[model samples]
Target: MSSFCLSKLDHPDLAWLAADRAVAADDDPTRTAAATIAVAQALRALGHHHLALTAALAAADPADDDTVRGTLHLQAGLAAAEHGDRRNAHDLLDHAAALADRHTGDTDPHHTGFGAAAVQTARSLAAHRLGDTAEAILRHEHVIRSDGWRRLPPEHRAAHLVDATRAYLDTGRPSRAGRALLDADRTAPAEVRSRPVGRTLLTEIIRGGPAAADVARLATVVGLTR
Candidate 1:
């Protein structure tokens, strides 16, 4: 369920499916929390901040395993970031980093592929959302330049690059944003092709930059020619 959701994160129907799964799994707190995180993310994208925050908070559980806790905190941190609550976002992201530190053990069914790198990648995202474009790009650079970067899952890396593209655009570097989006597509075609934000970013680049011709090719690949 999560794999599908992650793959087609732009699909509103898939998010609704995950939310329904959460409802069906009322007897399982872990599943409920995990599902809620995905739902919250989708809701946030659709401009339902209030509902998204509520769903994100529902994922929290201090007593859960580190993976689950980290995932929940990550979602909550992202939601807070989107809400412009810089302080809350930073604290929650910090807590998620701590949990990720303790994740040198077994994997759980609820694992969202979050780890130290994921936490750091999340810093770039939160920073970008909070109008700290410089810090956002700087934080993402740490992840990209890490020795263990190659070991990180393609999906996670692609997500980071997508967020990095946003940071580039925010910092008035549309060409760089175009390059990052192209890099993201190379990293995970499904993630880029199916994500609304990815396509939206490409559209903005095409409409707002001198690199429109260069970005237009990739934009066509990402189905943005429509």
Candidate 2:
């Protein structure tokens, strides 16, 4: 969990160290698989997309718990997308979706948060990473419209909103990007203020000219001036 938080906080090196310690401490296959998810996240943060994908795929055990295995596939899919393997990325995500169908509820057992909504959210991010901004926005819209979206953790929603902000920006929609950033801030202030990615996105939105009033205020709150 520390590793996961560290990764979210944009401290990939520290996250990697923590994930390594977790792997060393866990002997159970399922536990180790969970730890490997953190490892893959850290590696992805470090720009080692291929290694991250390989680690996630290797750690996935079908016999393990559904959440853990599905989460592993999700990580692998994201990594694959980042590594430019579009087919493999969607394939892995499809596999995760199938696993999610077997596992109902919005439970976060083992902190995996593996379920249908999570998978759909992952698809949005995967599409974004693959340079399909239109597809990313479409998936994001669908995810948020679903009942499962509201049930996700605040941090998760905020993080996805930040990514969605970027997608909007990429598609020449700064106003929409501003709105998404505001939504992210409302969902989780720390996700906007503490995460480097969020902060950077905020900076981009502000510098792009004529930011929303709320966005400008948020910049001030985060100690980022125009």
lDDT of 2 by residue, 64-143 (tens): 78889998999999999998899999999999999999887656568766788889999999999999989999999999
Give candidates' CA RMSD values in order: 3.1, 1.4
Models 1 onward score TM values of 0.82, 0.95
Q: Global lDDT for candidate 2?
A: 0.90
TM-score of 2: 0.95
The candidate 1 region of ten consecutive residues with least summed lDDT is 1-10
**Candidate 1 structure lDDT:** 0.76
| Residue 191 lDDT in candidate 2 | 85
Look at candidate 1 and tell me the lDDT of residue 102: 80
- Top candidate, metric TM-score: 2
Q: Candidate 1, which segments miss by more than 4 Å at Cα?
A: 2-14, 106-108, 209-216, 220-226
TM-score of 1: 0.82
Count the clashes in each prediction: 0, 0
